[model samples]
Target: MTASRSDALFENLLESAQRLSFDSRSPQLYELESGDDERHGMTPEWSPLYGTPLWNSLTEQERARLTRNEVAQFLGVGIWLEVGLQVALLRAGHSADPSRPDIKFLFNECADENMHSLMFVGAIEAIGAKFYQRDRALDFFGWIFRHFVWDEVAYGVVLAGEEIFDVMQRDWMTDEDVAAPIRRAAYIHVVEESRHMAFARRKIRDRLVGLSRIRRAVSTLIIAIGTHLIAKGMINRRVYEDLGLDWEVVRANIDGNEHHRMMFRRAAEPFIEFLSKEGLLNFGARWIYRKSNLL
Candidate 1:
């Protein structure tokens, strides 16, 4: 689509986003930045799906190491990226038309994202863990403002990221290990994010359908990022660094290794397979993955 058309589509989505309301059952924190869970005492939250056996399976060293590092990673990347991006994207995509539906939906989405981040951070802090203060992945996405002041590409990336979180939300909210308050929070988030995911997919799909070339480029970029960022979804780096592995070597292993291809595919394979089976994987997407050898 042309810039003007893309802008219009964004406006519509933003209008809808602003109108989404939260379930009354969700939790709240009196402090925005304090990472403390007011409902439950300071205990590390884990999905029941991660059985106690699995929890016990980890050695004490592994448990403590992950308790800090992995928690930090979750707070930094997941919270900031998901919450911070929504408001920024909405402000950028807002239109002059007050009646625009997308803007309304986006507003609700931003609110939901903010609440989600606060709860997530609070949970991290509840266990006496530190906030993820330094993360290159989060930094890189934050810095993309120089390229396009209000780029849809950035918005689309955040939407895709939310889908990843949605899966965990669905699984963990229902699992037995989650605390009652936290489970309520997850359930509320799952409902709100469901709408956000639909809008995100619509915005990207419509944008792609308008331009075969851009569609191909977007699909390729999403695949590449999916591979590098979320493939393993493991805490290997924190482990390696804690073990005194050279930071550079650890970074190289994570960044340069081919094994991440599997990880990426594992994380995204379900989505792609769903699209393919639904016959929504178009020629452009096929071409992009075909050239990348991701088929």
Candidate 2:
């Protein structure tokens, strides 16, 4: 895409953001009606243990607790990813021309992400769950990306994370079976992230032009590794352990769960296709994606 086209795209995004922005302190976020505690924190079909014999053995209350923990893990990881994106956006703005439409859109996106993180925190708290700690190794890599990466690589990583969450949130937001706070937060995130994703895709497409083959390969590998870490880190083993289940057994069930794998692949499909068309799905990257069960 040409520079003018890119500018126009971001200008449009900025307008939408300005018009649809919401307050994080809205009272609707705190009001929970009767029986809200009994609702699932996410769609039941998206549960990692769904359809497993072990899952079948759990009582309704136990199942609800497990889903709550799982949702907390997702929200916690989302907070981590959002913080990283905010850092990357600030870093990009530091060296960018303030007059650029893309930079303005990114700053707006950073503000949106801050509110989204707050919403995730509130949702996790409302679910009566604690944040799950990410794997140390993934945290280290996130630190590197937050501090140094830029251009297409930065936007690619951001896009991958957002796209995965977007898919799940689209389901959660509209599912009446989900908790009210979770559903509301998901709705806000899905709406706002639509603009962010558009901006990221346009940036990635614009930045990838004329890139050297070797650099593209390296960038592809980095994005794949980041995505693999994200997928692996989304569900913490502590979630099962805290719920009084053996981590090993739960891990085994999840590994063999075709339903869970299919959900992941479905979540990744659009982004995977985009990467392929952008020439970012080289052999190494494709292998990583397959290992992550995202391909």
Task: Give the candidate number with the greatest TM-score.
Answer: 2
lDDT for each residue of candidate 2 in 1-295, tens digit (9 for 90 to 100): 3999888899999999989987777867856757878888899888989988889999988888899999999888888889998888787778778878988887899889989888888888887888777789889998899888967888898899999999999999999888888999999999999999999899899888899999999999999999999899987898899988999999998989999999999999999999999999999999999999999
Pick the lDDT winner.
2
Q: What is the lDDT of every predicted structure here?
A: 0.51, 0.89
**Model 1 RMSD vs true structure:** 7.3
Model 1 weakest 10-residue run by lDDT: 40-49
Residue 274, candidate 2: alpha-carbon lDDT:
95
Query: Which residue pairs show backbone clashes in model 2?
Result: none
lDDT of 1 by residue, 1-295 (tens): 3545655765655554456545442344312233322222212342111223434555644444444455446445677567557655766766546445555556666767777777766655545455534446635645553234334455455664666566555655575443344455557667777777776666555545545565455554654453234323333355346645465655554454344344334435555664564344566656554433334
> How many clashes in each structure?
26, 0
